[model samples]
Target chain A: MDDLDLDHESVYDGLLGGDSSQWAFGTDFEDPLAGVDTMIPAGVDGAALAAYCLMLGDDALIYAHRLSEWTSNAPDLEDDIALANIALDLLGQARLLLARAAAADASVVPQMPEGSPVPPEDALAFFRDEHAFRNMGYVEALNGDFAVTIVRLLLFSSHRLALLQRLATSVDPVLSAIAAKGVKEVTYHRDYAGRWFVTLAGGTEESRRRLVAGLRTVWPTYAELSRSTQVETLASEQRFGVDPAVLTEEVDAVVDHVLAMAALERPDLPPSGTGPMGRIGRHTEEMGHLLAEMQVVARAHPLGKW
Target chain B: MTTLAAGRTRAREIAGTVVDPEMPMLTLVDLGVLRDVTESEVGVSVTITPTYSGCPAMATMRDDLVHALSDAGYAEVEVKVSLSPAWSSDWITAEGRRKLRAHGLSAPGPSPTGPVQLSLAPVRRAIDCPRCGSADVRLTSEFGPTACKALYQCNDCLEPFEHVKEI
Candidate 1:
């Protein structure tokens, strides 16, 4: 890992890899596939659609909740708002993605014998039973040293941002729209973590050491994100989703750069097997505790509107 | 004036005074979140956009909007939140941005695009030192005292300042 110095120049230096190119910020453009009116295509697999969405949405929601925990506990008062803003962005993405998943699933599931309105809350609530959340294992791991947290964030956000960038062109309008806005948020998030990675990796020997240990702790769980599930096939059929396998190279390149920049070595640990089932709801013990805290009040007062 | 028109005129007067919970100096109307005011048979309905999704203070703002309308003699009122087009710093009025600057904070710049070089643009491009009119400033951190602002230090005035992070 390359040691980054905060003393010689501003931290923003080289954040974009010294690229002189300007990056557009918002996802407010007109849709490329706009005007083609078409019915749902043949053999359209709705279950796969719901599963993929659950994977994306659950990741956003759980991670947003985790990030929110850092509020007021950040190293500086400013970071409180920064982290909170990032969390809010993630929450917004989760709401839209989850809503999209629910809407897509609703289309396929056999409705009640008679027509009945299925409220949004119920749609969101009924999807999971603990063995199917395919979020990157990085976010759910117990909060580790700050250096480690930044590394994990850097890894996750870059991957997510890249994923969203590809999804923005999806045949599904809803998915495309959500991905469009999401790309910007994820970009900011990735940069924030990357700048910090450079700072810590280059700051001091102690910061450097902690970053390495943090990388090892978080790296094992990342394999789960790279695996291709059946959902990817359904998404590809729909024409907007990227093959998760294709993204491995991009993810690896960035991760290697950051790890190298941080003056840390990627651990050569053999992969401990874990994949798609986690996103389907088989979360580790940490998730149960997190959900207990997150869902407690809402569950206790079911149907209670604030 | 007609009775319906008269009621609307008064309701607008009351809503005009509600301040933003985040940026205290600016009114909600100044931030452009408060949208339409519709008078139904039951009561008056006020629509607004949230600055960020899941903002806890929105409930408080809604309550405040209702109370203020009631205090002004409009008994029935409804507050609606919309997320379409989302929220933009561009929605913030010029006067609100001025007030933010007066309060020692820089207004947000436009959101960046595709790939950005922060060094090329310079840290204080969108910011002007409210205390001193100098343009030479450097951002020390993206996180500021508030979520909206980034921490900046002025080169000329030698003062640490906050620049609003453009969403």
Candidate 2:
């Protein structure tokens, strides 16, 4: 408020306005596609495309949050940065994909109070109810341990990388554009987790045991990731998305190869459930808790801008 | 130059002067994030691309550009982000590479093209120590202090440095 405060705000104060770039309590949300043409192609199914985007976006957002839980909990500093970096990459993907979904169907965005600084993408992320979230349960399950997280990341990123590689050729420009960017990022994520998979498996006796257990812990929900929900099928039929079912072969080859390197057998655990779980809003009770931590600040400060 | 031509030049000059908040050694022009700047009816429009899908530096980049241009006397300014040609470490200008090395940061190598091979083995990057110029630099971690960088330690010089990762 005073001249001294203005002058002492570091080098930024010398500019036209002092340091508006600073973040408040959380990331400052803006339109991820602010400058790009966001028009949905006429031939594309708006509803299906929106649902598909939300599906992928929700998965990334939730998975990123779970990864963040390992921020200070990783076994080492290097692992900590690696996990958080991967989380940041996915969060970026989520922002753009959610923005794409809102562009396709404004109705998908949840309502917020007046004067809320939250954008469409942020609103979709924070305001939606748990059942309304379209993320698969594979990512929503609580983290078991460092090994469990690495296993989850390996599975999710492998599956997502395959999906994005095909989605890059989608008829929809935005979807294709998003997919192209995501492919490069998820490549690093998959590679990181895959290496860890092999390392942990081949490590000390206790590490090998934990690694095998981690695989078993997540195998029950493996079926959910490969099962194509109705929206995915619709989007694929409309040329706006890729169905998860088609990615099964590609993802399996990668996972199998990694497991072979680790000298570990594939867990023969049965599928947790038969068909379309999370995509239809069916999720574990813990998703509510994840959303509570993620959304509480936004909901509490709908009108608070810093 | 004509009035409009002069204005265009002036607008671009102001934009070119702004540096990245995180990596201040390189101007936005040096960094490929600044896509283009053009004069428009209302004012001038600037377009940029994000280095990564979830780069936190984007907000600062936009805010800095707006402040710099406004201070330079642009009446109206608009900043836009494009995602079509996703940013690559290869986009860093030649001068930007020099700046990065001069500041003890390893510049990224040529980006990978075509299908990205999935190797469980660590990525083998043939990099030299920025400080010692020794080819014996080894990778410490694939991820680093920021999302855009990776940690490396030079075996010959015994110094740790960050490499601007190739996305």
Candidate 3:
């Protein structure tokens, strides 16, 4: 039979045309909320809205970078692709949210050299210093192992999915649209992480031990995620955003169910209030390292275009 | 008739025939991503939506739209990606579903109209095998090679196939 008549043609065949080489990594980047009306609500403070978007956007950006670190390092090819896809999803969300933040308050996006063609979202992502980032402590924490990464993803995606579900109804149409699209992606992220949590927990003794240890290591950071800052609380009050604190119960329920299914005990660890609040542009030392690597190229060549 | 009005109709007809690069069997209209097509004195403008936030196919679709329109004598063509009233699996046309099944990929089931259940477990749903018309299929993986599909194995046919996931 001819190649055209093959029953199981490669999926890559569809991806082959139209300069496929340029399609790698960052080529497909586009403003997800491009055509949507991004008008800020009448009563909402622009700076406050920008700050809130930065908080969420920075979390996704930093976490996506960390996940991308697993590029060719995942245990299996499938997992490598899975983690990369998840990272891309978060990265896409980050691009839209950061662009929204920049649109709200130009000050949040760092200034570049004269005639810099870098987009605001790229500026916010690649130019911001560690202290300027507003991501939660858990996502910035170094990836310990596969189990640790999966546990962090489970908690983070769970909390995010719940929060996005409510944010989908925000008074700000742009935020609401971003959240509406985000809920579907985060749902998958949460489910993927939860399934891995159960599988690792119920696998061999070594895997179970690692999963428990990973959970214990990551549990203390959960408190920081649910902690609503002044801006977040104010935004939620004005119906511009969802309060992260309100999502605690829904997030906990999902985590609890997954842990139960895995036959694992919930770790009763104290909150790690080590660094300044992540909501207010303070992060762990590891975050600085992560940023250094992530921003090196952009900082070196401010006007360079990919 | 005004040139703009005539051009708009022609633009829509041209765009309607542009196939999804990934699912070559389905047109953008069949996949419900092509939201609107309009024409003006300057050029034609087309709006499309992504199947998922990170669907890589959007870039190809945009390029395809531009190429197809430009080749059709439209000097300037703009492809706008929208996310507001987000795309849903329910928007997949009935003809699109039939084409998908014919290609040996199970079509997406009816989307749940109510709020999605926030749970850890995979939401259980019955998926019939596209090859054998059997409901005895089990999901082997939540993800497939593409963002919008899942891997499933049919017990009756003993064949593994991809199923468009209902998002």
Per-residue lDDT for A165-269 in model 1, tens only?
788877765666667667656766787888777777787889878877777777777776677766776687767466677788888887777767656677887
* lDDT (Cα, tens digit) per residue for candidate 3, span A178-284: 89988888887888898889889988999999999999999988888888888888999889898887888888888888888999878978888954388777777
What docking tier does model 2 reach? medium
Clashes of 2: 0
Candidate 3 wrongly placed segments (more than 4 Å): A1-31, A274-276, B1-5, B118-125, B132-135, B154-159
- Is candidate 2 or 3 superior in lDDT? 2
Q: Pick the candidate with the highest lDDT.
A: 2
Candidate 1 chain B lDDT trough over 10 residues, lowest sum: B115-124
Chain B structural similarity (TM-score) per candidate: 0.83, 0.96, 0.93
DockQ of every model listed?
0.10, 0.63, 0.40
lDDT of 1 at A189: 77
Ranking by lDDT: 2, 3, 1
Residue pairs in clash, model 2: none
Cα lDDT tens digits for candidate 2, B1-167 = 48888888888889999898789999998888888899876799999998889888888888778878887878898999988888888899999999999999999999889877887887799889999999988888999988889999999889999999987
Give per-residue CA lDDT, model 1, range B1-167, as digits (tens). Answer: 48778777677767878877767788887777887777655678887766654444555567677768876767787777654445666778888888988888777777665552212122345566767968877777776544455788888998888776666
Clashing pairs in 3: none
Candidate 2 chain A weakest ten by summed lDDT = A20-29
